[model samples]
Target: MTGNESRVAIVTGGSRGIGRAVAERLAADGQSVVIVYAGNEAEAGKAVAAIEAAGGNAAAVRADVADETAVRAAFDLAEQRYGGVDVVVNAAGVMPLAPIAELDLDELDRVHRTNIRGTFVVDQQAARRIRPGGAIINFSTSVTRLNLPTYAAYAASKAAVEAISPILAKELRGRDITVNAVAPGPTATALFLDGKDEATVERMSKMNPMERLGRPEDIAEVVSSLAGPARWINGQTIYVNGGAA
Candidate 1:
């Protein structure tokens, strides 16, 4: 895309992992990027600095995606800094796993608040503020389909995201916008690897047909395509799960 034709993108949870990768890819693709992190100021700063070093315009903003005021402020900052937002990637999520019998309700609430409610806050802002022909990309996980033993709560939350995506797409029909979700399989991220032993991680990696866990950049590639000139793709959940589900 030409520099003038490039749009501005806001990537939530963008300090690290999949979010970071998506932010970098968007910046590289010529879209001015705003990277939103919850608490990691250092990591956020590093992301912004890297983008600048690579000749891409970027800024880091701190916000809890689950907070309406924070989410709105993030959008406002993007608008003030870059005129308007054309793309939003909702990559902020939490994935604590436990069997249903042992699941902690408090932890469940936290996950739901961030993954489901957080998605709504960001998506609502994008719906209201995004330019015509802009795109809204939400994150889901292949675990929703895999139905792993300990993923009950997490899957339920993501299932809610999947449920809302098509409706939002239809809601934005007249405005020439697209709303979609990307469901990734086993990916190598702190969130995915945390608490898992090497054997567990290796087993998860082998679950994919590709015989390896996904890289953040792999998911970023999908986000890049959806945010670009491919306006024809709308109201769909595209799986970037390496055929895992």
Candidate 2:
């Protein structure tokens, strides 16, 4: 593909929320997109339909990000159909909040399995198969810095993501690929809003100087820059938190 024209992207968790927004934005920027969702075929269909309705090319694939085989298949599909993938956004994550003392061991394992292992699995495939000049954007949370209560397990998992992303960037030195993490704070998505009371949501909104929660489109803008022309920005965890941390 010349420039953004006809380039391709693979966006995990693209069926909804930030992933969906990123997929739509990349497609709008002229890249074909593969929306890799865990389940929720209906949501995946909606994302693809929205992209196609906007005159962009997109498809949906159901795969567990933590599953190496499934992730590889997702990559294979992107390569086989679009020639190659130019961007891989590892946005599939699960957050079950609880204080460290009360957190279930099983839940901690589940969180790590999806957030940490999933990031590694998707990043591995991206490192292996993505075309040069590609970008790998992983998701993290500002809680690692905010040190919020009831976020120990989730924060710990994302901290691992932050640690590894930069190392991967260095390891891919000769290749023209960028590895980075987007750590958003208090974004307004089902992932973040679910189970949160109105008062709790308001409290988070006021924590940021912006006095408002981030939109999915807000995060998408950053990803768009990284995936396309922001090659100088590598091995960094950008805190897209409106100065919350």
Best-matching candidate per TM-score: 2
Candidate 1 residue-wise lDDT, 160-188, digit = tens: 99999999999887998899999999999
Q: Write the per-residue lDDT of candidate 2 for residues 43-153, one digit (tens) a residue.
A: 999999999999999989999999999999998899888889989998899999998889999999999999999999999999888888899999999999999999999
The clash count of every prediction, one per candidate, is: 0, 0
Where does model 2 exceed 4 Å of error?
A: 1-5
Q: lDDT (0-100) at residue 206 of candidate 1?
A: 92
Q: Which 10 residues in a row give candidate 2 its minimum summed lDDT?
A: 1-10
- Go through the candidates in order and give each one's C-alpha lDDT: 0.92, 0.94
What is the Cα-based TM-score of model 1? Answer: 0.97
Give candidate 2's total backbone clashes.
0
